[model samples]
Target: MELLPVRPTIKTPAQAFTGDVYMTPIHSGTGPSRMTVALVRFTPGARTNWHAHAVGQTLHVTEGVGLVGTRDGAVLRIHAGETVVCPPDEQHWHGAAADTFMSHLAMLEAKPDGGDPTTWLEPVADELYEKANQQ
Candidate 1:
């Protein structure tokens, strides 16, 4: 057993998210391990753009409330202690609700051939957010 080197927190890119968001890499396995873990935080109303993972992703909510939405119009409200699994190539987004801050640990598996783990698309529009919030 060993301790991983510490790293600075990272701001989520504007091209991938809206509002205030941050992430800290926890671990990134090398070679055949092919896994990554990150702690992500989102301020109220902050969220990711539509995206998908090559090998899918999992999220374990740790604090506040979270909203996960899919392109096919499914929206799930998640709270602390909840886990969300996003299937590979499923276009979706996740973030904090408008009234609360949220935090989660994201787990992702990297493709063996070095393909991008995530493919980011357009941002979530206000209209969509409003509609989801109403549910």
Candidate 2:
């Protein structure tokens, strides 16, 4: 077992998210491991754009409330201790509730081909986001 060095949390790029978001890499296994893990934080109303993973992704909420949405207009409300498993290539996005901050552990696998594990799409529309966040 190897102890990884500490990594600084960095702001997420605006191109891939809305509002304030940060991520601290926990472990991003190199070589043949291909596993990626990180602790992500989202400020109120912050969220990622529509994206999907080649090998699916898992999110374990660690603080506050969160919202997860899909292309089908389905939005799921989650709180601390909840875990969401998104199937491979299932377009979706996750973020903090409009009135709360949220933090979660995100886990996924990188393709052996060295391509990006997640494919990002357009930002969630303000109208769509407001409606879904009306809670």
Candidate 3:
């Protein structure tokens, strides 16, 4: 097997996130492989917009605390070394809790035919964010 080339880290865009965030692509499979992996970091209170993966996604927390909220109003608190699996097309948002910086590895799968792997929706509202933080 060949070593993957090094790539620059990418700052998350304001349009896609609510607070300070960044990501480093670990492996975006080429050729026949359909997997993508990234190391994502979020500052306290930072979070992604609602989104979903075409195939599915798995997140493994590596440091600090994380919050994963689902459309059905389920908010899961994930600590370091914990893992969470989000089913395919299941809308959700994930980020750092209000009091800590957090980092996680997100593993996602692309569609077999090479279409868009993720569908990003609207940002999480302030009310929802507050509600989550209060939990």
Candidate 4:
């Protein structure tokens, strides 16, 4: 196997995210592999919009606390060294906790053809966020 070069970290677009978020490409699989990996860092109170993966998505928390919320109002708090797998087509959003900076390794398989592997929807509103985070 060949050694892969590090890719530049890109600030996540506001359309797909709220607040500050960045992503560093890890491995973009070649050919039919279609596997994509990135290290995503989220600032305090930052989060992604509602989204879904074409195949599926796996998130491994590396630092700080993270919040993974589904469309059903269930939000799970995941800590460092924890992992979460978001099933394909499951609309959900994830990001740093309200008071913490978080980072996670996001892994997913892209469509064999082309285009984005994830379908991004609307931003998670404050009311939803607050309600979802409630115990």
lDDT of 1 by residue, 1-135 (tens): 888897789998898999999999999988878999999999999999999999999999999998999999999999999999999999999999999999999999988887779999999998998788777
Q: In candidate 3, residue 10 scores what lDDT? A: 88
**Of the candidates numbered 3 and 4, which has the greater lDDT value?**
3
Off by over 4 Å in 4: none
Query: In candidate 4, what residue range of length 10 has the lowest lDDT sum?
Result: 126-135
Give the range of the ten consecutive residues with the poorest summed lDDT in model 3.
1-10
- The per-candidate count of clashes, in order, stands at 0, 0, 0, 0
Preferred candidate (TM-score higher): 3 or 4: 3
Per-prediction TM-score to the true structure, in the order listed: 0.97, 0.96, 0.96, 0.95
Clash pairs, candidate 4, are none
What C-alpha lDDT values do all the predictions have?
Answer: 0.94, 0.94, 0.93, 0.92
Which structure among the candidates has the greatest TM-score? 1
Least well predicted 10-residue stretch by lDDT in candidate 2: 126-135
Better of 1 and 4 by lDDT: 1
Error of 3 at 45 (Å): 0.6
Any idea what lDDT model 2 has?
Answer: 0.94
Model 1, runs deviating above 4 Å? none
